[model samples]
Target: MIKNYIKLALKLMLRKKYYTALTLVGISFTIMIITVFASFVDQIIGANTPERNRSRMLLLDKVSIYRNGKSTDATPSVHFLQHLPKLESAETVSILKRNEFVSFLNGKTAGHVLQQTDENLWNIADFKFVEGKSYTTDDVKSGARVAVINEKTKEHFFNNEDAEGKSITIYGQAFKVIGVLKSAAAFSKLYGDVYVPYTTDMNLHTTEKAIEGTYSAIILSKSEDARKVRTELRSQMRKIGRNANGADSLKLYPFSSIEQFAKSSSSNDDEPEYGKTTIILLIVMVLFMLIPAISLINLNLSRIGERAEEIGVRKSFGATSGALVKQFIIENVIITLIGGLIGLGMSIYASKLLIQVINSFDPLFKMPTDTFIVSWPVFAFCLFSCLIFGLVSGAYPAWKMSRMNVIYALKGGNSL
Candidate 1:
């Protein structure tokens, strides 16, 4: 029976080429837009590269210092980093500061962004080394002028040769390259061309009785331990504020996922509106699909009206209304599923083309073409959308046809 339904659906679709083409185009475009949007969002939130342990990590990128009804934005300080180790829930904590890009001159000069971090950051971030090893705590404490360069930096300086123990001049100072890292995507937060110990510069450690400075802390902990970590952090902040003598109060805002980071960047609120953003996105996609679904539904109704005599004849031959409804629903679902496959193919093609175009113009972007992965979650979302589309566009037409009076239907009279 199911095979017959599919066979009949194929025949009918081929018989009405115009309607079939219109429906397929509509469904395919809608699904393609949806899939592309889903893939983009997944790329933003999904873990990659150095931050692969993002699910178990939290970022304290911004701090709020409130004084006399005014608030000032500041980065985390060495004070915060020193206290994070006391938290029982924390696996490891790290601090880093964005440094000025220094000119690297061997034969040619190139500027690269440098990040100053501690040894603990190496443990927290999974930076894949290409040549050597990360700097140690002893090196950081001793203020050694050692640096780790990324793959791009290595090529620019050494031309595919080994970079380890090579002296590179930066900001009129010579530093020895200790390591080289694999390339990281531009979207990654921890990506940098060069990494050095924070203690190499005394300016980053300049802090008075205040707790605000130019440093950001990253907390590495299990997902289950996040609540405890937050609680402990809040308690620690209160303790620091108590000694501030009514001129200062500190707050630690942690962004555990891309969504949180986006919300924080977009607004001044401490809590991210993840649920609201999710609902709004869902509504937008549904509305996007609904426009085409409504048009297809009307088309289905008109097509069913043209086949009134056929439906009437079959009904008179002991074809139950339930069987007719099932067949029509199945036929619509088949059309939608086919459209889904076509849409998936189109999305993949579009993504590749987009990557190629971007890479052609901007070599410095460093974006991976394979970043848009079609994971199981994406596949499931596509199937769910297809099912909703099938039912919305087919249900009313099938029900109306099922309830038609045999006498009127046989006489070529249309009624709803």
Candidate 2:
């Protein structure tokens, strides 16, 4: 019985080759677009997880003071590092200070400030060492003039040569290369190439003022409970920096929290509604699939009308409604499944073409390598979507074919 249904299904599909082709094409295009969108969203969310030791909590000044008729925001201040005792309980605390207009080897200029940090800075950020090692406690204590460069910096300056133990001039002073970092995503603010000891300025530059020149301090909690640590740190900061009314209004944020805040703040006020965008895309895809499905359903109904005598004859010969429905459903399933397989193949080819187009762009603008590569999830998702579409689209047509009245259908007076 199943074999007969499949045979009939194949004959019907072959008879309407143009319709089958159009349905498969529509499904393929929709699946391809969905796959690409999923990959892009996955890549964007995954960007925040590049470093293994990303902090759960970050310490920043919360107080905003007005001085000289100008309001000063102190939420992300460096002074919190010096006075906050809550940081001592933290798993690790790393101070980051930037020095802009710093010169490097061969008169290469940097528009951004060079970051200075202690040995703990590397541990706090999970900086992947490609060559050599991170700065040690001894190096920080001795105020050694050693630097670590990121992969981009290595490519920019040393070319193919090993950067380790090489000397690079920074701010008219020579510093030895201790390490090179692997290329990292740009989610973190520490995307700069050069890394120097936090103590490099002890002898060269000195300032007693707390807020004179400091970038920010990052504190990593031993446990995942960063909010608790942040609160404690804020309370300690309030004690250290007393306001006129002696109130503490400092804010502390976990690393992930800040990212959400940044994204929300960065969204354009006039952007289209997310629900509208999603609904529009869904409606379009459904319409693309719906037109073909409806046409196929009508085609199947017409084919049934022509074959009404056959169905009526079978019913009179004692075929049950259940058996008839099963036969018709199986036939439609076979036809739709064939179309689905074709669509799946087309989707794979289209996805490959899309990835190639993306990779042709410069690395800076291109999608991440992981995202560009099609994984098992992509194949599974495509297969499932195709199966659902095929079954649902064919169900209505099969049902209508199964519901014929034997007497009327046998009379065969243009019944549909």
**TM-score per candidate:** 0.80, 0.57
Write one digit per residue (lDDT tens) for candidate 1, span 1-416: 99999999999889988978888999998888888777666655666667778877787877777898788877767655655436677888888877656463455655576788888989988888989999999998898999998887788778879999997766666679999988665456676778888887667556834466777887887564455677777777777774643546767777677546457445546666666677777788889889989998898988876878988998999889998888889999999888878887787877766667877786544455654455567768887898889988888888888888888889887764
lDDT of 2 at 177: 90
Find the 10 residues in a row with the least total lDDT in model 1.
363-372
lDDT of each: 0.77, 0.60
Whole-structure CA lDDT of model 2:
0.60
Alpha-carbon lDDT of model 1? 0.77
Cα lDDT tens digits for candidate 2, 1-416: 78887887678667877855665565556556555554444333332433344535453323454444554555433443544464555787777775543444466543333678767777767567889988898998798999988776676568748999998777778889989877544334554467888778643344333333354666777776555665666566556554522323433433433333333444432122345545655676566556666666676666777677878887899988777777777766665566556655665566556755765764333322322433456556656665666666657755665577888778874354
Model 2 residue 388 lDDT score: 64
Instruction: Please count the clashing residue pairs in each candidate, in the order shown.
Output: 0, 4
The local lDDT score (0 to 100) that residue 231 gets in candidate 1 is 72
